[model samples]
Target: MDKSVDLQHYYLELSPEPVRFDAVSQLTNVFFDDAKQQVFAVRSGGATGIVVKSATDGQNISFCMEDRGTIRSIKFSADNQVLAVQRNDTSVEFVPFNANNQPNVPEMLTHQGKNIIYGFVWVQERQVALISKAGVEIFQLNFEKRTLKSVKSLNITVNWFSFCPTSNFALLSSNMGTILTPVILKASTITKLPRLELGTSQGCSGRDVTLAQLYGTNAIMILRQLQNRQFEVVIYLLNGPGLAPKKSHILRLGQSGRFAMNIVDDVVVVHHQASATSMLFDIALGGAETEVGSGAVIHQPIIPAKTIKPYTLEVPSMSLDGKTINCDLYSQHWVLFQPNIVIDAKLGCLWHVLLKLNSLCALITDRFRLVEFLLQRTEGKPVLLNVLKEMMSVNYSGTMLPVIESIFNKLNCLYKSVLDNELQSQMALMALSTKSQSSKLSPVPRVIVDQSDAYTGVFSSITDTEQLGKILLLYLHSLARNGITANPELSKQIVIDLVRNKQFDTLHQLLKYSALNESKPLACFLLSLSNSDPSISQMALDMLARLNANEIILEVLLEKGQVVEALRIAKQMPGADSLPARKYLEAAYKTKDPLVFHSVYNFFQAKNVRLRGSPDFLKHEQCTEYVQYYQTLISTQCL
Candidate 1:
């Protein structure tokens, strides 16, 4: 059975190019207006105005907002030609932009102290819906005339309002504090709906409460902290047809005693201030319920039936220095912000992270910065080469390969220099020894001649086998671990050199550490070479025995015509006795080669004699047939 699994799950996919925007000081909100090909960012406090830039490359453009006050909230029109800005001083204004994305003078649409703007949403082109502490209001924008007209108004305090990302339904919360009724926006009609409260109003007191409509669905997530310091997130299918409650989850906070949350692709991720670990929970719309006893409908929440395993990522200085990590869902990418690094969940795919890292490496114009970031991120693990392999294998620009080749070439040159130095020193010592020994050289009697075991023949140039084995082991291990492939022909030449130079022990040691599939050819080569040396032969057989290669060993014995030894070995192994027995039967009956018929007949006759009057006496009955066959061969003068 093949036990290898696919390696795609081990690495992440990354894009070769990444878009980075310049830092905005005191930035509060960012939104993209795709129709205008521009991105708008709003800042608060000092020198406040909307900054517009090309969305593709984040280059500053000629467009800017006219509102000079502290902008409370900013929303773009559906046509991307109009802008609405709410200020902290209870004022609301609409600014219209032209084809060149240049904004004109703003027109104030404030309620004149009768209402305070809470939030707003764009339902249709040339129309805007506003939520305020007083009620809901709909306004129409006359594009050619550049004037605003009030279309509809409601008398209710809406704390927050947002439209569903997919469905046309809009969710409106009447209040941020205390238990209150929320409403739904169906076309232009407003209808009151029950709020998806996570806990009772008493347990929610003295705790922070938040509500957000999830992306791509009509579901709403209610996040609240209990008075006892436990945080819970409950998801409710509040609007649309056949919507219902889905699931609930709890959170634990540590360290600085605070946490942040973000939802992406139907999953909620929470990161705490005191630790680097984050938790992820899956929230799906529909699932089957488990069987239970029928009783009154008590409105208790059904705990979520499925759970998503939490994905843990390393954050630098988060736990030691109490630095918090920021998580946000930007353009469907879950980005985790640390002090010196940004980890996007798109990194879970191997290619995506490598390309993004390469882009970041190029952007910073420092390869060492990316290397440092990777080392710090992995906490000095051996994944540096792993990251490098991913970066190299997917690179098609023909840039990084030369850099890698040059690096390894320099390493090879250094290693060769060291080996040459060591060889020169050893040769110098050998010369000195010969010179010293020449001074006392004398011819003695033939019976008293002396000899040393020093190597002085063809094998004299070979290095120490043990030390050579160590170096080869290290080299092979490093390449294998990084998933880099050396030239196959070069590898074969190296092995051939080892065998030719009489480094059998080193070759044997290397074969032991190699993977089974990679070692097969080398094993066959070793078996062939083992015949020249008894020590090498024993080593080869020992390796085969450890690997449970019985068939090969039996083949070896049979090829040398050692039938008795083969039979003895096969007999000790259960279910292997039939092989040798069948071989002898074929030689006597089928082939009719009778030069050694007596030998085969004698073996089974001995078995019959040994098992006489026993339960297995019939097992040797084939001996009688062999005896008769050999007798007939002798009568025919064929033996």
Candidate 2:
């Protein structure tokens, strides 16, 4: 009846001799050279180069020039036969891997002005697109004819750069501080497509701009700005023509520590963290505002041992179809070393099931067949069932029915057996009571000791209340569809017992039933019950907020309007004070209601005190000024 599944899988883990390189700050790039059967790494801060043989072999290679400064960028040629290395302070080198499978002496490529190449991509075996402080430059190589050409140079400051996979179009970040410009390229001709001006340039760190394609047509950029000494993500979408560039939408990710965005087909996978655990959001560029998939941190090796083990092995993976996402626990083996197989079909099947489960109705028959196929082929290998349960909960109408029914049937049978045992024990007690009354020469009382009382006594004998609650949960869930409302008081008592015992699963079922009914008393009771549990309080608040419970919230706030209390609840509920604040302010301005004005002014003062006049807060002066002036007026009146 708990209906929760354990989602754990084995991932490759490697315990290497913690190799540290001065130049190897982080693994910035990874590319497989099929022709050479090798993998190359570009170390960001140091001039050294590290290369490892493909997972097929376990050989390590390092290349460095004592005088080459730091490696700014490195890219592999399309044919995987050549490596292009760009160094800090505007220098380029070409290292060719020879017949011995080792990098040969570096060949100088550029002899130009100080061109700080920030990023580059190998367009073809010959041509490479590079971004510098000056502008954009295209370099070409001709192996057959032995020719190199500078095809074109665009004179515009580019802060960030990325090329379309299938097109000549290159996305350039407008050096107008933080604004972005998309440019269409046709061989030698460069046309600026359009620019979308997002937020003001203030506090925008140009270094944080990351570019990726969103749903093919749109260009997505994630911008970071310093807020309260922390970094937050500001997502921007740019599409359409140069004159009328459409700003699709903007989202403010609260308290995101570090973030990474990668586009796969129509979906964008956003990896971010607010606290200890990393959160993954599978965002559909073409669909609704809500994310398609959500997952939490499962494993992180980078965290220190002193800190809580924030990393779990569950890495959430999104399918290319944009329908399903799964969280998988990778073996420490796979995490450190490359996997032997190209793909884990079992993991693939689980991911497919998660995506299909997103659409419950469509997945019912189709998903069942797919699951059957996986079970047959896999032969009962444990899959990531946690992700499967989350998906099933969302789309639980058609396809979920059979799965839920199967689980429910087993639980129901178990509960019925337990109930039968309870019934027999109660009968035995009544028979004993009858015999004792006759033997003692006492009149037998008409009142009977029922099974509920006997069951309570049996549960009281158990040492662990937690186990007892779990048993009761299964029993309660088995009765969910049997019209428990026929005995509302009994149902209410059962819910209270579960709540008191911290049996959340049963409480959730009861809340679900309460929400389904249209009765006000039931709704209020459910809301109160939800309010009692912190886990369900947000759900209750959202439901009540939808019901336009502004009056109710305001009334409660007036009695408990301590600054801390007001701020705590207000922060949780966006636009919490908007309605009440405006109403009170209007009453004060129009009717000269001192009490109303004082309350409105105090709310504004509370916010000002909390925010402490930050610059970002100052930018929205109209809203801030109105509240400040009203508060000042109240201070004058009180004086």
Candidate 3:
């Protein structure tokens, strides 16, 4: 069943409909605010009007703007109360709106110094950051006064700046996009992070440097086009205490062309313009080790390049004349944004690429890597659980053994990690009264599939109980191999199946290695099976002996007419004097064996001499009745 890929490998697809706008006008400018997920279109330099559309809300808000002199940079403040429009090299005009959202008289604010403004971003609801050639300046917007107040400023030569709203950090690149500094602008504060220096032969352009959070790590990704026209994305991690950016991974993109990146569910999706396909890469998957001395592991795409599933644009636009149209994806005017947004400015269409998670299962050939990759995904557990069911439904084969082993091991490792984290958390809580003593608060990609989940989802659903039990043995073995304990119920089920199949050797090993849990009920159940298999019963008895269950042991022995063994066990046990000595004699008398009767009487007589200073049954001993019964039995034997 492994490597059963879909015919088209349709792992990714476009949304059913592309977001439509007035794209017919080539004179209009389209800009996307990564912070708010809003797309803005200013027609003929805002002479027609400004149209703002939110991808999430699907609502459009349009406001008229008087002719602005060649608007260079424009965006709404975080609260949409003020419209920030940059027209010149160093000044931005802030226009506040009234209760009716009509633009008021604009207030102009220039840069801190003469440095030309490269870009600007809305850092907060009322704060905006201006990135310039020399540094960044953060300003607080005073919507009531229709003015701007300078809050914080930093001076460092910068070539470009990239911000990731998810991580709330911005990257500043200088020295031709090689030396990068990171900053966190949030809650009206600017906090500087460590600076990283890239030693690539040639620095990347501003459009090539991207900042994003991949699977809980703040990552700086640089897309470099090789001499052969091939491209690779170098990832540097901005985690760990006071540590410099570490080049931990490099995605080996074999194809060459214009490339754009989108991190979907921690999986990096690289879209190639020329091929019109996206290749998936997961950092969690193992790949070739080390390309540069930096020791960055080189990774290949998770699957082959597959085109986005075709989509039909349903929105009727002025250009389309009220008709549904099939649009060209990956078009010449298509602009890719961080995370997963894609837009074609000329068409005035926007779409968020979606991953077909179930389709991914079929595309991946290696089961181990599939599990490894899926285990880290946010919605992977359910998919993985389904995969197990599929595997179960398939016919067993020798080739499937290793595949099952790999999956089981991966699941166990993930479970182990979860258990370890929980234990550490508990210990940390113990060290403090109200707070944990731990400091690392980073995200780790893990699938939380435990043995019980697998059993319930896959194993127990099997109608063939016999085969299910066999598979359960293999499953339990895997857990045991990983130093994990199984539920007692699961242990009992497997043992029942083994016994029913008469697999004594394997059953013995299960008992020997202590894979099965020991309990009085299990021991009694095993003892019941003595008639069928004496060895299994002995195994049960041994287990009980190990558990020191003297009462059950004595009961079993007396019931079997092993009066000597039962009495001996009772005598060796603590509080033997309190044990009913007369009971053993009575049980031996019921046996009607002369020798057994003699031995039972002698066993009690020895106890009486040791405790009462004479070898005679005392009145309170309560064995005189059994002694008389034994004499009568001996007399009958003589007759």
Candidate 4:
């Protein structure tokens, strides 16, 4: 059963371009430019054919160059018009390309360095950076002037570095990758953030540190060996300026030999070469040991560590056409880039890692945590709805009730947060548009699971009204805590169920506290339940009373033969004399109680006198018929 769940939950899908290898140079000539999502094959320093291809967009750009010793780092401008090549320690060579593959005059751009240039990357269309033992230097290339101008440079001793193109962010490591400095590299500006010093317990190696965006925040995921000698991926989120970057998570890869990582759908997927399997962790899980200031450490994988989904690669075959063959799931030569890009230069293939959320539904036994994790995904709502619907479809036995309750709590918690934030944002925007003293801008809000979404999608189809009533009440009680309006149809069902179970006091308190959605139709529904328990009618009457819906209140009172109560309410209205109290008198007449009939008559008679100074009915007044009935009742009683 576990294997069945693992079969489809996570895997790697092939990107468009899998075969970008040069048969002549094989794996030896190729290098990946992650910033452009392109792979380049430099044949003999480009004296032979040079080729560039992208797995992302099927982009291919090729040019030739006279042998420039060994190309260390290479990248092309955004427009593919200028190529920056690093062949030596002192400087980077910028060669402009005109039209298709023709070279212009090459320009040498050197950086201020006590040390040589280690590697470089193109920050923007014409901006590039050179990192060395000394520091990082960002420079701009002016094609028109044929010059390389210095932009901004940071002076700090660096051992190695990693870059995330998504935010134009970089992490420079020194003191053996334990001391880290974060900086934002823009086309014209470099915002260097505060330096972070890793604790001594964590390893001091520089090779294992990688920078990437996880959950939309630029963070460093370092594969470190702890003091206990166990390997863990220690992640530190680099927050905005003035806020110190903090260590947020620790993903334990027990007995790790060599592990690589990728962030997919905000989940951290760690691939271990020795085990030939991958383990996934969602920090949102808030692991058992989420101790404050110690960073949350996830002791176990979400699902047992499993190999990547099986895939077939196409290669030349003995048949007339190429045939697909099973590819190794976790190859030693496989290279992983941030946010789900994987490449195996030796196999001449690139496969993108993906998480199949639909299959994940089964492996996540803790339903509440499943929902909380899904709430953060881009394509999660429909999946969440489907999962919730399945949970609702179960027989709703007592054992599963706690699990369902937990799921509801998670959904409502997220819903209330999203709703409150959106309302605040809207209010702020309105204030800003008018330029009022209250002008303020709220943080943008994100969508999440809400109450109505659950009802309409999951609970509405419930056939067992009894079970549904209990479940609905549970969900509604959770929603009530969040201050969200409960669904009326659901409220009606709950009231009926409560009445059936003889939970009148609970029902009364819920109505009195306004826990259920209050509406005239709901009040009437409660009136129907009065046959089971008379107090239920009073519940309905009280609900109407709170609304000041005197008309409906009078109908309910008279219908129940509570003539005196009905008359009292009619008298309390603003236009008490104009109130039509004839129904109250008629109801009293029907009761055959002469005293009740006579009291009702006197009240109307007094009202008539106050309105027109006549005890008898006026031409416009409609009380003559009631008066006759009252007199008949009195005579009948005397006889």
Find the candidate with the highest lDDT and give its number.
3
* Global Cα lDDT for candidate 1: 0.46
RMSD, each candidate, Å? 24.8, 32.5, 4.8, 5.3
Q: lDDT for model 4, on a 0 to 1 scale?
A: 0.75
Model 1: per-residue Cα lDDT at residue 360 = 29
Q: Tell me how far the alpha carbon of residue 272 in candidate 1 is from the true structure, in angstroms, after superposition.
A: 2.1
Which lDDT value does model 3 have at 388?
74
Model 2 TM-score? 0.39
Q: What shift in Å separates residue 299 of candidate 4 from its native position after superposition?
A: 4.1
Q: Give the higher-lDDT candidate: 2 or 3.
A: 3
Better of 1 and 3 by lDDT: 3
Better-scoring candidate (TM-score), 1 or 4:
4
Per-prediction TM-score:
0.39, 0.39, 0.82, 0.80
Shift of residue 227 alpha carbon in model 1, Å? 6.3
lDDT of 2 by residue, 1-639 (tens): 121211111111112212221222243444333223345555434454465434334455555434355555555565545667666556666656656545555443552447677666565666766667777777776544444577877777776565554444566666455566666655444677666565565424444554544434544455564546544444444545555354443333445455443333222333343332222222221223432232211121111111111122233368654443332323111111111112122232111011112222222333433233222222221221222333344333454545544443433343344555566667667788464532222222112222243234332333234343343443344445432222344445555566666777655654554422323344355557765676655444444555666445443444333333444456566675343444344434453545555565566556656657532233433445446656677678852
Candidate 1: which stretches are off by over 4 Å?
1-19, 26-39, 42-49, 53-61, 65-67, 106-113, 143-147, 159-171, 174-176, 180-192, 197-217, 226-228, 239-256, 284-639
* True lDDT of residue 406, candidate 1: 41
Give the Cα RMSD of candidate 2. 32.5
Q: Give the worst 10-residue stretch by lDDT in candidate 1.
A: 445-454
How displaced is residue 159 in candidate 4, in Å? Answer: 3.0
Q: Write the per-residue lDDT of candidate 1 for residues 211-314, one digit (tens) a residue.
A: 34443434544455557766555455554544333443333232234544444323345544444334444333222332244221112111211112123333
